[model samples]
Target: MIAQVQKPIEEILEYLEGRDKVVLVGCGGCATVFHTGGEPEVKEMADILSRHGKEVLAAIAPPFGEFTCYAPWSSKRLSKYRQEIEECDAILMMTCGDGLQVVRESVIEGEFGLLKRIYPATNPTGHMGGGPALFKEKCQQCGECLLGKFAGICPLTQCTKGLLNGPCGGSQDGKCEADPERDCAWMLIYERLKKFGELDRLREAEPMLKDYSQMTRPRKIEVAPLVLE
Candidate 1:
């Protein structure tokens, strides 16, 4: 699930920017999982828009109790939910980043063509961190790894320099360079392996650097026709 955080009435109010029949499309998946993305917040958003003097054409979504994962996860069948979005002049997606992108792409590819303006209510975050482990900052999205061996404790994914291996020796008492409260990623990795009795795996020194293939810029993945069909 991808997410965009829209705070301050202005970010959305500005989008209304003199239009009244504004439509808000709330994502069932992102909203159900995260408290901020759900219908109460959507209602508050609608109220905010209404208070700002814009007419909220409608707020379209299933009732609050539906489970997002077990439910459909796209705008692919916007027709299933198009009327809500169509009721207004614009769309405000409360889904994660990918959901919004998928919807927008589909709308562009579909017949309802009501795409006037769009805004993300939350920043898109990947599915890795799950619910509570939400990334406070970012991963740098470095595709390299120090995780497969270190019992999944990643010095690189958690480290600031993206160090390929081992601690910089700058970590004090297992605390990280970036934050003392956070454990040094390498140290945590080391401890994890020790606990799992996989210390022998550490003797296998990893390569001097990562394979650049994964580092290739602007990656894109496409399934062949067999997968599509």
Candidate 2:
């Protein structure tokens, strides 16, 4: 899941400066799951904006399945609220950057003039696990999967120093030197490998350094179109 945290109210107010008649758009996907942009949060934002002397023209929660980051879905869902949105001076999107981009694209394609500014109200923290209490970041989306070699622990994230090979010299008593509160990532990997009798895997030559070229920016993929014979 995409983890996110609410932006400071002062930052939001600054973005909304000189703009009244605001329309609030909330996401029902990751933001909702994180309790940062659900219906209740949207209403709370409206109240705060109202108290700040800004008029809230509407607070819209996109219908289920209409994820705010899916352009086609969000575009269709937003059509019904076009009039209300057009009437507003700005839109405060209680969602991550991806959702904000989707909404902006919808507004452009829907021919709602560029006069209406779209602003993000939440900052994406990182991708995380789905459990209620599992807020810790689990993956870095580095365009590489090293779980098999590391025994499922990501040293890039779990280790304070992001050591790929093994425990640093600073590790003492299975505790991390960077942060004594956390277990050393390499130690955990060793214990896990030992339990599985796969310690020989570590005896192999160290893996090559990660190639970041695979993670080039503005990446995209396309599936070939199907044709009937």
Candidate 3:
């Protein structure tokens, strides 16, 4: 999931300058998990704007499973607020850049054809994994899978410097040199491989340089659409 944090209220207020009537849109996916754009946050934002002398035309917050980044879900939920959305001077997206752009391009422009101004209320940190209470960045989406070689550990993301081969001889007492508090990624990989009697795999040399040709931006894939029986 994409990890993010809410932008400062001062920055959000700056975006709302000269705009009286505003519509707030919240996400139900990563934004909710990160406490950035959930239903409660949306309602709180509405109250804040009202207290600031701004007229909040609508506060649209989808449930925990309805993602604002998904056009179908957003379109369906937003349909009820069509009049308010069209009349609002601005739309505040309490979501990551992905959801914000999707709502702006796919919903506002593509579906409604409104040249509406949409602003993001959250700043995305990065793609992360882990749950319930704590989350951490675990993947870089490097377009290459190397877990099979590293005993399921991703050195690129886990390592501070993204070393492809092994530790940089800076680790001390199984702790990372970059961040002494963090465990050394290579040490973890080595221990896991040794436990499984796969230490020889580490000796098997491979290309050290990462092939980033396929790591282009705006990557997309097309698959058959979901059809319910």
Candidate 4:
């Protein structure tokens, strides 16, 4: 999981100095789990702004993240906040790059075409766990969730060596043969899979030099706006 932290209060104060009425926006999905920013942070921000004599119009929550499932199903959530966000001086986005970009574009044409915007917040860094908690994994951006396929473990992405099969028998007692801090990739995978009932997927025989064009590295996808008839 990625562990993202918010910027210093002084830094945010600089951007929010002039704006009296502002909207503190948070992605309840990601921002909530990442613990980077949320209503608590918003309240903290509000306190700071109020100390400096700024009136926060509202603190709005939207559903966002890699899984943008919540907002689409619950349109009423954002619909209620649209007026507040539009009329307000600014929106402090507490989300990932993707979520923030969408929020920024949500305002099509402002009165000034320059509604003061700022990403004064820090970037998100980590993986989403089973309970949707952030696990603070390194920013590998592996683009592959091999943990499931590997019997609830990840060797390719987690292992420093990027070993697909795993470390040789030299690895002892979960510790990596090469490094103590790191566990033996294959051993961990084997044990985890054995714990789970899906060990059958393990013996499926992974191919060497397989073409994964669909799962290309550093993959970027093109997204067109939704066309509603």
Candidate 5:
């Protein structure tokens, strides 16, 4: 899951400068889970903007819920608010960068040039751990899975220094030197491998450098449709 934090109100105010009319677009997916871009947050932003003497034309959550990041779905959902969006000088998106980009694309596709000024109200922090309440950064989404070799532990993310081979010399008493409060990731991996009698695997091969090509920006995958002969 993507994790996000609300942008500072001062920054929001600066972004809203000279835009008297605005529309607030909230996300119901990860943003809602992180308490950043949910309906309540949208309403709160609207109230704050109103207090600042800005007219909030509308505060709405995409009808497609978690799929708001998809341009087609977002365009359809936003179409209902065409009048409100057109009348507004700018749109304040209470979501992560992806959602903001999707909304902006949707607006462009819909020929709503008046709503070209799009702003993000939240800053994406990182990919979060699984489950509803775990907002901790667990995965880096490197496009390569190395958990099999590390005994299910992610050295890249859990380790402060992102060491893949072993615990750094700075590790003292099983704690990381970079952050004394956190246990060393290599230590945890060592213990887990030792318990599973797979400690020998560590010496089997040298750790290879991460393949950054797999994590190139603007990455995408295509699923071919099935054709019956």
Candidate 6:
């Protein structure tokens, strides 16, 4: 999931300095999980904007599991607000950057064929895993899978320096020197490998270099449509 946090109200207000009519849209996916852009957040934002003298035409939020980043889902859900969307001077997107862009490019500009100023209210930190109580970044989406070689621990993400060959030799008492609050990633990997009797893999390894060319930005994929029985 994409982890995100809401931008400060001061910053959001600055973006609406000259705009009056506003439409607020919230996400039901990551933003909901992070308490950044859920239904309640959208209502709160609408009230806040109203108190600030900005007229809120509509406040819309998708149901949980309906991601605002998906073109079809967002377009369908937002179609009912076409009139309000067109009348609004600006849109306050209480979602991650992707959701904001999708709403602008796919829903507003593509479907409606009308250009409107859209602003993001949340800042995405990174793709992460773990939920219910907490979330932590687990992958960088580098377009390569090396977890099999490292006993499922990703050094590129967990290690401070993304060291692949071995530890940075700066850890003390199993704590990372760069980040004293966290245990050394390499130490964790070493312990895991030792427990599995796979320590020889580390000994026979050489320094590794990541092929970043595979990680070209704006990557896309085309998948076959799902067939329901």
Clashing pairs counted in every model: 13, 0, 0, 9, 0, 0
Candidate 2 vs candidate 3: the TM-score winner is 3
Q: Listing every candidate in turn, what is its Cα RMSD in Å to the true structure after a full C-alpha superposition?
A: 4.4, 3.6, 1.4, 5.4, 3.6, 2.0
lDDT of 5 by residue, 94-179 (tens): 88898888778656445465536888899898878777666677888889988998999999999998877777789999999988
Q: What is the lDDT of candidate 3?
A: 0.91
lDDT of 2 by residue, 56-167 (tens): 9888886444568766666666777888787888999998898998688756445455566889999998888857767887777777888898799998788887878777
Score each candidate by Cα lDDT: 0.62, 0.82, 0.91, 0.60, 0.82, 0.90
TM for candidate 4 is: 0.66
Give model 5's TM-score versus the native structure: 0.88
Candidate 3, number of clashes: 0
* Candidate 4 minimal-lDDT segment of 10 residues: 66-75
* Tens digits of per-residue lDDT for model 4, 1-229: 3345677767777777677777776656666666655557656766667778877777655433432223332233545666776677766666566555554544323222435464546566555444454263532445555565776556666666766655556777888877878777787788777787666776776665334665675577667745332
Question: Residues 113-181, candidate 3, lDDT per residue (tens digit)?
Answer: 899989989999999999988899887888889999998889999999899888889999999999999
Best by TM-score: 3
Give the lDDT of residue 93 in candidate 6.
95
- Candidates 2 and 6 compared: the better one by lDDT is 6
Q: What would the per-residue lDDT of candidate 6 be over residues 1-229, giving only the tens digit for each residue?
A: 9899999999999999999999999988999998899999999999999999999999998889888988778888899999999999999999998899989998999999999999989889999999897888888888888788788899999999999886999999999999999989999999999999999889766447788877887877677744322
* Model 5 stretches with alpha carbons more than 4 Å out: 63-65, 110-115, 130-134, 223-229
Off by over 4 Å in 1: 1-4, 62-72, 81-87, 108-111, 125-146, 215-229
Candidate 3: list runs displaced more than 4 Å: 227-229
- Every model's TM-score: 0.75, 0.88, 0.96, 0.66, 0.88, 0.93
